[model samples]
Target: MTLKHGPIKNLDMEGMTMIFAVAKPEILKTLKVGDKVTFEADRVKGRLTVVTIAKSK
Candidate 1:
């Protein structure tokens, strides 16, 4: 999945847009392009992957 998010303070990353693989692709099924979401991401097997995701309140 591709995400444009704020800096991940824990990862010491600057805010930027990027595409990442989703560990649970099914989670994306209910989302739309402009929806706000909170997700957990990580590098797995050298690929960025979204471990968990949810619609933001």
Candidate 2:
């Protein structure tokens, strides 16, 4: 997935849009363009990855 995220001070990352790999590919089916979600991300296998994600309640 690709995301435009807020600044992540821990990573010294500025808010910017970037592509990420997901930990679980099945999760993609539950989402559509413009869906609001809360997620956890990290570097997995040296690539930025979304570890978990859920629709905003």
Best by lDDT: 1
Candidate 1 residue runs with Cα over 4 Å from true position: none
RMSD of candidates 1 onward, in order = 1.2, 1.4
Q: Report the C-alpha lDDT of model 1 over 1-57, residue by residue, as the tens digit.
A: 789999877567788999889887788898898899999888888887888888999
Write model 2 residue lDDT over 9-55, tens digit each, in one string: 65578888999899989988888989888887888888888888888
TM-score of 2: 0.82
lDDT per model vs. reference: 0.86, 0.84
Task: Give the least accurate 10-residue stretch of model 1, judged by summed lDDT.
Answer: 6-15
Please name the candidate that would achieve the greatest TM-score relative to the true structure. 1
Clashing pairs in 1: none
